[model samples]
Target: MIAQRDLARAISAVENGHGSFAQAAATLPETARTAPAYVVGITGPPGAGKSTVVDRLIENFRSAGETVAVIAVDPSSPFTGGAVLGDRVRMQRHAGDRGVFIRSMASREAGGGLAPTAQEAVRLVERAGFDVVLVETVGVGQVELEVVSVADTIVVVTVPALGDGVQTIKAGLTEIADVFVVNMADRPGANRTAVDLTHMVRESGRETPVLQTIASEGQGVDALFAALQSARGGATNAARAVRFEVLRAVRDRAARSALAKLDEPAARAIFASLAAHACTRRQATDALFELFFTGG
Candidate 1:
């Protein structure tokens, strides 16, 4: 059995793409592959009560004798190189629960939705024997759509008065949602938002399920769970194969990019050149291209 400290270190190793952790993760048993845990992705615009919904889901999952792991992706503080990790604070009730493993990942400028480290963190949690894994992304535009590729079921949460859900549809998030959730259903425009989402789904010709909930009061959570289960049952093996291909591509790109950043002298030189170029109002891309072709 891996100790908690060791597990934490392993997670960090994987996040950093270190060789030892990669070996360990690869050596994990077939049972790890066959485990019944369902990965759920929760994403939405900031302040859409996503964390509240995740909290409710965690509570419900625990009540049903299931162990749960949560991977909360927080926006990085540029100056600090760290995350405030506010979402984890909201889930402190599960801190002492042995059945729960909650990790907060910093989304450090890996735009287009999730941080590279977030995916590794999920793998760590999944291998730690949790019966379920819930990944909450740093709710940033269409990038959050990346969650759809990783999660077995994605719950796209939205709130009322969000512009007829048109903005979300335009962002392409509405297409990836396996379950659409209109949280804070007590709000005036909540029902309207739900209806609009249903219409949008119908228009897209996809029979996606939408659920309304007052997450704060734990309303309609059971229906959401049921919908998720039904979707899981209907999920085909072919879809999983495609998802695996996408995940492999994502991991490969991230690994290559991480390798490119390890040049200490080159990194310093590049930064210094960029600073000098900025003072002259020159484009950094032009300088980068010149450096690339000239071997400067």
Candidate 2:
């Protein structure tokens, strides 16, 4: 078992683009790669008590003799690109638990409601021999669908009474959730919200459970944990997920190249020439390719 300081240092090195984190990850024993660090994604709208839910989950998993690692993604400051609301304040109760490792990450323009490195961090934690890796995302609704790629089970947490019209807006979330938790269930309209979610899940032809909980009080956490354990391998398609990541990386590289060209004088001159000649799409594409690749 890694000591607290060493684990934190390893994760920090990975986040800052230094040290042997990647090397360590690449050299992980085959057994470590397939270890049982069941990654669970807990996501929902802001103020849905996601942090509280995560805290309760840590307690439940620890009680079961499971060591857990958490990568909590918080929105970044637009000005400084630093995490705006770090989880250290919310999850301080676990500060003394050797079984729990918590790391807060800034969602620094990675998009899709996660830090670009979130999945890598999860992999590192898994490779380090944790029993569970919990990824709590920024909870920006449907954009968080990518969490399915990393988490074996996804629990969508929502509070009761999101107002009259918001339920319809969350249909996409309902579809991706393996377990729908209506947190703060002690609040008004808890049953109604649960019933609505149940109907949505039923209509989708899936048997996803809609559970109620008050995470702050640890209510319903044990059942939630059981559901999480039972729901493993529900959303993962390893091959497809790997392909998507590769495609996304290529797309990002292409996008960066195009954006860079937009500010280049040569690209501008080529665009002007193409426009002046009323060039066909293929002709303009060929010219642009030549400008960037063939250096024409």
Candidate 3:
């Protein structure tokens, strides 16, 4: 059995972009890939009861004889370098379940967006024999759309009374929700919110499916599961290939840009020298620029 500390170290290694980490991630059996696990993303506004919904979802999956892994990203505290990670505590009932592995990640000044490390973490969990992987992000505006980029199915959760539902739909969030869940369906206006969402999605000309759920009591969960299955069935190999090509292109461009910024080693050395000199009142910006550029 891999020790918990070792597992944590492996996750950190992958996060740091080490080649060995990629190799380690790949060694797990192809069975892990073929396993019936689904990578589901649950995201929404800050107070939309997303955590509660996730807790219920995990219970439903586990009861159906599937193992589960959860990666919950929590906002970081700039002053302390620590995170509240309160969502993990709410789902602590699964802590002792042999088939459940739950990990809470500190967003760590990663701008409350999907951390670069999250993809690596998902790879690790997928390889660990879990039949399902659930990722819950630290609710972020706009940039949270990155979740859909990594997940097999993105479930965007929202509530009716918040009055922010329409605005959220107007933003990019509506575009990425493969499954739109009107959580807290027991509240008034839930049906209106659902109808509004259905109409908006139809108007957008996207065929995405929407479902309503009183997630607190497991209401409407079966329909949500059916929608997820339908979406997964449509995930063809051709579509996957296109996504990979796009991601690779983006990565290549980023790499080239980073390399260009550091292309002049001698100029960088001179700038370091000038910076020290300026700190000591030995040079001004204009003088440093002229000397560095003119090689004088």
Candidate 4:
């Protein structure tokens, strides 16, 4: 097994786009892929008690004698391109637990709503011998659905305040959410929200469970833990996740290579003009191909 410090370094290298992650990851035996760690994705809208839910989960997992790693993704500051990483503060009590590792990451302009290196970071942690890996999103809106490609089980946490309607079902959330959590269960309207979610899940022919919880007081957390523990991920989900990761890596590498070959000044000018126009995406693609291939 790789040392914890080495695993941390590998994740850092990948997050920084330093290319060392590939080399470091290659050192692990092929068996690492077969005996993969369970990855759980915790996502919901802002102020939906996602952090609190994750905090409770960390406590529960640790108490059950399981080693856990957390990747809390926070939105990047547009001005400074840095993140406050406040999730770490909420989970600081676990700092002294050798079995639990926590990482704060900034969602740095990745289209998928996760830090581009988040998947690789999870892989690094899993290789370090953690039993469970929890990924917490920035709680942005629907874009958080990207987590479906990275985690084996997805826990979608929402509060009772969001009001029931098709709105809750938007963004393909119903299709991807393995388990739905209505947090702040002690608050009014919690039962209504859970009922609505249950109705929607049943209507869609899925057996997804909607559990109610007051994460702050640890109410109903044990049930949520049981639901997560019992989640059965089929081979199809595993295959899809692996395929998506491979495709993303290939696309990123190709894009980097293309950018490296472009004339910086010319590329900048073209992009600036494109940004000001009402050009469709296909049109922009054609322009890029013309410029890059036809030397226009």
Candidate 5:
């Protein structure tokens, strides 16, 4: 097994785009790259109590004798481009626990509620021999459906008061969520939200599981744990995850190579024009992308 410190370095290299993600990743055993479905994505809108749910899940998993790694994607800082908050604050208690590894990654304005390198980071954690990987997204409204690309089981958490008609929801998160969780169940309309989610899933022709929870109080988490375990027993989309992983890696490298052209004299002229507002950002972006695709 790769050391956790080495795994952390590999993820850092990937996230910063500073080094060869391939070289760093190659330090792991070849088995680490196999089709593995040990990831569980916990995501929802802000204030859905996803962090607390993850904390509780970590506790349960550790108690069940599993080593857990967490990647909590947080909003980025305006100046430093780093995580506004690290390790979910609530999860700091586990800092001393050798069996639990938690990291907070800055989303850096990436869409789909995840950091650009979050998928690769999850794989790095897996390479470190963690039994389970929990990916928590930056809860920015409904754009979190991207979690499906990485996790074997995607748990969508929501609160009780969003009155947006579930029936009117379209081809989005509602259709992709493997499990729906209505957190803060002590609040009013908790059961109502659960029922609405159930009905919505049924309407979509899926028998998805919907559960309610008071994550802060650790209520109903046991049932959720059981449900997650049940998912582990079933077939997973490991083959799909592996395909996306390689595709994304290729695209990421291509983009980086294109960006590197900015230092070339020809590209510098474009940048000069861009700085003088002689051309629009769209023009500059198109120029760079053209260089990448056409080798111009």
Candidate 6:
């Protein structure tokens, strides 16, 4: 079994872009790389009680004798670049449990509700032999779509009375969800919220399960777990999954590299031209990309 300390280091290496996950993964056998852990993505709008739901799910998985790892993506502090609300703090009950590993990653203002390297972190945790990996994204409304590319199954969480349900529609929550969960079900508007979501899903012409839960109190979590089991696919479409992840990784690195060169001569020249209105923002951006890509 991989030590938590080493696992943490691997995730850090991935997050810092200090080392390649491909290299770290090479040490393992092919089976480990081709077969990934079951990744369950939990995403929703802010204050949808996502973390509490994750806390409840952890208990269920642990009770079932399945090892679980949680990757909680929290918004980063712009000043410090550290996680603002650490989800690990909410799952302290599992701190001493060998079967459970909980990690909190800062989204680094790259919303879509996930840390930049969340995909890499999932693979590393899979290598560590976890039976299930839960990726809890930042509840950044519309941006929550990114998790669809990573999770084997995505549970879109929502609560009662969310600004007339337009927030959910704009987020494309119904389209991407395999399962919909209305958390904080004890609230007065819970049934109405569930009904609204069901109607939306029905319009898509497929029957998607919508379950309700009072997550903070662990009520209805068993039904949620059972729904997840039924909803998740038996096996992922590996090729498509790889394409999404690899392209995103490449794009992320390229964007970071381009930003790092902003103060350099080429980038500065582009900025100066833009400042003087000598070029459209589009042209300046194109020139900057050319300069970065060509090593100008």
Best by TM-score: 2
Clashes of each: 2, 0, 1, 0, 0, 0
Give stretches of model 3 more than 4 Å off: 1-6, 16-20, 23-33, 78-80, 164-169, 236-296
After superposing all C-alphas onto the true structure, candidate 6 shows an RMSD in angstroms of: 4.8
lDDT tens string, model 6, 1-296? 57788888888888888779986665444434334577899998888888889999999988887889999998888788766766776787887899999888889867677888898889888988898999999876655577877788888888888756555555455667788899989998899889888877787676778899998888989999998777556543244456766888899899999888889977888899999999999999789888888875
- For model 4, where is the 10-residue window of minimal lDDT? 26-35
Whole-model alpha-carbon lDDT for candidate 5: 0.81
Candidate 3's displacement at residue 74, Å, is 0.9
lDDT of 3 by residue, 1-296 (tens): 23445555667676656656567565444342465557888888887777777888788788888877888887887798776777876787787787777877778757635566776787777666677888898876655566765578888888886564466467777766888899888889888888888888888887777788987788988888777667764572236435755886888786675456444665466567666774433444454445444555
Model 5: per-residue Cα lDDT over 1-296, one tens digit each: 45668778888988888776687678765544444537899988888899999999999999998889999998887577755765468887688888888888888868778888998898788777888999998885754566778888888888887775553265566755778899998999888788878777777787789999999999989989988988884655456557766787798898788777768888888889899999999998888677667877
For candidate 1, the TM-score is 0.76
Worst 10 residues of 3 by lDDT: 278-287
Which whole-number lDDT from 0 to 100 does residue 64 have in model 4? 89
Off by over 4 Å in 6: 26-35, 165-168, 235-296
Which 10-residue window in model 2 sums to the lowest lDDT? 26-35
Let me know the TM-score candidate 5 reaches against the reference structure: 0.77
Q: Model 1, residue 136: what's the lDDT?
A: 91
How displaced is residue 102 in candidate 1, in Å? 0.5
Clashing pairs in 2: none
